[model samples]
Target: MDELARRSFVAAVLGAVFFGGPAVAQNTTAGGVTRVALKGYDPVSYFTDGVPQQGSAEFTFAFDDTTYWFKSAEHRTTFAADPEHYAPQFDGFCAVLLSRGRKVEADPEAWTINNGKLYVFSGKRGVLSFNERPIDIAQRAGENLKQLR
Candidate 1:
């Protein structure tokens, strides 16, 4: 890899190790299945409010076998109406890492909205790398996601 690519790879690995692992959308169980998506951050708020807002247990919705919380019932209703629109790309994994063919958990606070789509990052490094070439990274991430599926 080139020097920049090598540095980015290292950053992603370190971020994953220090921060967290790949986030599986589903956290299943025998008693019950409840996986709070985006670490309980209201996905809709990322768009409507332009920031990450902690969700409430009182307003939760289940979609694609994963549970999501909302800051309010209105946000929940908005999400229920059209979930795919508000949901993060790469199933909430770090977008930059996804573009590089890695599955790493993303921090909701380290995120960006591009072309009307929300993309989260492992940290500031990932976000900076993504901002360098968003269209290309997003395209690569989309292709990687398709291959993974």
Candidate 2:
């Protein structure tokens, strides 16, 4: 297979294993248009301005066949306004691993926020593990992300 094809195929497999769905669901706004969360329920719109916007500003990357939206237009306007507060770490990756100085793809449903930073995990179970060591996980993830780049 060609390089791009190989990459696409790998991405597909990884997405399926990590995201837990072949077709990710798009979380919509109160108006019920545009996509958010890729396949999970974020509800940031309701929290921010009682409405969801077109997209998130932190990292606009397509995931699980859908686009992930942000907290509000303010998120887009500033691009750094509470980034850790809104942006999913490690591109929506597993939080526990982040805390362990590693990065792994996560299931959208498994999520939590600490110090305003959004953390995603492989599943509810992983989240539990993360909860057990929030500070350590946060510190490790912060240090590990630099190496990933």
**Best lDDT among the predictions, by candidate number:** 1
List candidate 1 stretches off by more than 4 Å.
Answer: 1-33
List the pairs of residues colliding in candidate 1: none
lDDT of 1 by residue, 33-146 (tens): 666668889999999998899998877665544567889877876775666688888878888988889877788899999888889999988888998999999999999977
How does each model score on lDDT? 0.76, 0.53
Write down the worst ten-residue block by lDDT for model 1.
21-30
Q: Any idea what lDDT model 2 has? A: 0.53
- Over 1-149, each residue of candidate 2 has an lDDT whose tens digit, in order, gives 34575457446544553555442223343567744442433425423653323443443323323345544434332323233345566656576776676666676656666666667787789878878888887678777876764
C-alpha TM-scores of all predictions? 0.73, 0.49
Model 1's TM-score against the true structure:
0.73
